[model samples]
Target: MDLNQILAQLETANDEEIKSLLQQYNRENSHTFSFEKRKKACAKLCQSVLTVLGRQVQPSCQKTCLETLRILSRDKSVLAPVATRKGILGEDTQSEEEERVVVEALKCLCNVVYNSPAAQQVSVDVQLANGLCASLRNAREWHHEVGLFTLRLLFLLSALIPDLRGSLRREWRAVRLLREVLEHTLDVRWVGPYEAARPDPQALPMPAEDNERAMEVLKALFNLTLSDPGGEDDHQFRLIAALLRHLLMLKTETEEKQRKHTGDKSIQNRF
Candidate 1:
């Protein structure tokens, strides 16, 4: 079915039918549906997913809807509907078994904001930075399955919207939260004897399983401070500088880590 017909079906379709129709669209034309074809219907199609989300339908069905959006978002022109939609990037997403639905939503957000300045702005207007920060609030409840995409989108926002960096730092305490998450995810902690902070590493390459999440945090930190006019004594600067001391202490088989690390050993090279 075309976009309009399928949307009409969504108004009355059963749970299984919702999933089947969404999946069929995703399979057949969510991609091939073309930008001009979807331009007018994009908002309706996006709302259809949200409408499905509003119902007490199966999580699988919600995921199908989100997955379809994720595919449709490949066309940046059609994302205004998605960009203006609040909660699309927020933390209230349904966290079912494995939090599949939540991950799917983040993936959609990543697709929406990865290159669209318009979507990025709307995401900021909706205060999604706070929502993304909420995802890391409780370490025990942290969604490990959703880690990469969450941090990735957060990084994109911080990078794409220069104006948002300050809010993310102050309003959300994002600097501290990101630091805590990096420590927790990497299982690293520094004890006693503090070392002065230093410059960030040029590259943070490591095994995908080992460093992907850490890399995401590093990339976000770079953007968060990208245009910082602050000096060394600045609070965000200090905290990250302190983090620099420990980040360098990590034992990595890669020379890039060793050469660029911020621990004591690098202090000698600093001067």
Candidate 2:
């Protein structure tokens, strides 16, 4: 299909057509389509799709557009928009859907970082973290799965790059935003009526395992920021103290809940 047809398909097409358009876009222009190029195109098309969907009477088209962005986010190219000065992924200049795409793209980049070393090599962790911080608060209506995924990304990121942690320590907003989300994860309100609302916390179902992983990531980030002997004299002692306190509380809460449940079962058995 021609470019106009492709763009048209992207805006109005069903799932299959959207996928096909992406595939065709990639296949035909794979070599020439640099990450920046794809990002620009995605940004432009994403804006158009959102504009069109926004006017529609139905919600499905808007949802489909969001879903398309979610899928496109898997490509590293798509995530680059967030890191740009224009803040396409950020709340600074973009519309809601545009920002949503950027958030999804960041999550995708984090997954790529975990799964592939090459992608991480191409990114500067501090820049990516800055982008992520910008997205977190703005996406209050974000899907819970996206929230959970973003949290996991934060965990992995804080672990993978120590330098980023140092930058984050100095960057109060980034640190505060992350702490807020960490607090949210601990909130009962975060748990909803259905299984879907809760973040699986566990890569497995066992809470301890998930918490353990979370601890590892946090510890890594902390060490990067506060544990470097040559780093800084201040070493962010206050921030580290707060993080340590939070970690201990989380552990204590988890243990207490498990113990209470186990005690209840034992009492029932004795009866």
Candidate 3:
């Protein structure tokens, strides 16, 4: 179907139909619709999806709309609204459903910034940087998944916009939040698959995903420190200490496992 026809259908379609059409447009190898054509209709499609996101829709519907927005975010026209919408980044995101929407909105914004410097400018122009900072602060008390997603989005935006470093450092208080998260992760001894295989009785087991998220936050802080160098004295020292401690633990555990395996091999050989 043509872009106009699809847009027309979207105007009247229910949640399920809108989702199906959006999914069809997002398909990489769709014979019926071209991304080039869809690009022309991105503004309209984005508006429709944004409307869906604003309402009390099914989780599946919300997810589909979010995925569509991520695709549409390649266009600055579509991305600006996604980034700047107060509803997307607002304090109302306390429930799991609301958090999902906020996470998706941030992801869409992240995609736009990651894809185009022009979109980054749009984001800044629309004050998306401030909005993101607010969202980050709010998500700190939310589910860890939400917090991780927010951090990932912030990392992408800061990486793209050089000027954002100062804003995040001062206005947003990103460094403090990142440090807090990193310290929390450090306190929890993360015994993952490898640790389980080795069976370290001393280690406290944490979910592998939690450990992965913590590492991602640490990497984000490291990336931020690379560009903005002044504020890292205490934060950097603590981060490095935590990292070194974790590495040393891993090394000690691995060596212990290796020695035990070697001793078992030697005994078998002697027998």
User: On residues 23-92, what C-alpha lDDT tens digit does candidate 1 reach at each position?
Assistant: 8888886536356656778667876776677667787887887888888778777776666645354324
Cα lDDT, all candidates: 0.69, 0.47, 0.59
The CA lDDT at 85 in model 3 is: 34
List model 2 lDDT by residue over 122-213, tens digit each: 44533656655566675455565455555566666667766667665566345445544444443323232211133334432335534443
For model 3, how does the per-residue alpha-carbon lDDT over 38-68 read when each residue is reduced to its tens digit? 5556667666667666677677677667767
- The TM-score leader among the candidates is 1
Candidate 1 regions exceeding 4 Å error are 1-4, 29-34, 41-43, 85-98, 115-118, 195-207, 229-271
Give the CA lDDT, 0 to 100, for residue 136 in model 3.
54
Q: State which candidate, 2 or 3, has the greater lDDT.
A: 3
Model 3 is weakest, by summed lDDT over 10 consecutive residues, at 262-271
Instruction: Give the number of the best model, judged by lDDT.
Output: 1
The clash tally of candidate 1 reads 1
Looking at model 3, residue 147 earns an lDDT score of 70
Model 2 C-alpha lDDT versus the unseen true structure: 0.47
Which residue runs does candidate 3 get wrong by more than 4 Å? Answer: 1-4, 23-34, 42-44, 51-60, 74-97, 125-127, 131-141, 188-201, 204-206, 227-236, 247-271
Compared with the true structure, model 2 gives a TM-score of 0.42
Q: What TM-score would you give candidate 1 relative to the actual structure?
A: 0.74
Clashes of each: 1, 0, 0
